[model samples]
Target: MSGEERGKRAARNEDLFRQVNERLHDLAVISGSSEPHGKFVCECEQTSCSLLVELSAGEYGAVRANDTRFLVFPEPWHTSPEVEAVVERHDRYWVVEKRGTAGAEAEDLAERGSNLL
Candidate 1:
């Protein structure tokens, strides 16, 4: 696949994972859970990845402040260097910012709330 196509695909995968995490967060809030941190799945490009990262609501909110950014496991393998860059490194997870085509696609997905079904 072309680079742009690959970037788009990666963006879609990451967005889907983000949606799942969002739903889990919402559910936790509705259930009145007082847990300080939640286990969110790694929002990476790889569909086969099932790794989970723990983050508090505030930390996840920081990542969500930018549409192009995502929370991923703090390992090199969870990041796609071609379409994203590691912006922040934490103990259990890393923040990645999508660039180029991937950035545009991620922003679009966030704005439209599309491709979640």
Candidate 2:
């Protein structure tokens, strides 16, 4: 696939993962789970990735503060340098901000209400 196509695909995959995490958060709220941390799937470009990262609600909220930002594992393989940059790094997870075409795509998805909680 072309570079732009690859970026778009990555954005879509990450957005989907973000949606899942949003649902998980909503469930936590509904269930009144006072747990300090939640398990969220890694928002990486790799389709086969099933790595889960644990984060506090505040930490996840920080990552979701930006439409183009995503939560991923801190490992290097979890990041796509071609389409994103690591904006924040924590002990358990890294926040990646999509750039260029991928960023536009992520913003578009967010605007479409895909992140509704």
Clashing pairs in 1: none
RMSD of each: 0.9, 1.9
TM-score of 2: 0.94
lDDT tens per residue, model 1, 11-86: 9999999899989888877888789998899999888999999998889888988999999999999999999999
**Model 1 CA deviation exceeding 4 Å by range:** none
Model 2 lDDT per residue over 1-117, tens place:
999999888998888899999988889878988889988999999999999999998888988999999999899999999999999999989899999999999999888876544
For each predicted model, how many residue pairs clash, with residues at least 3 apart or on different chains? 0, 0
Instruction: Report residue 57 deviation for candidate 1 (angstroms).
Output: 0.7
lDDT of each: 0.92, 0.91
Q: What TM-scores do the predictions have?
A: 0.96, 0.94
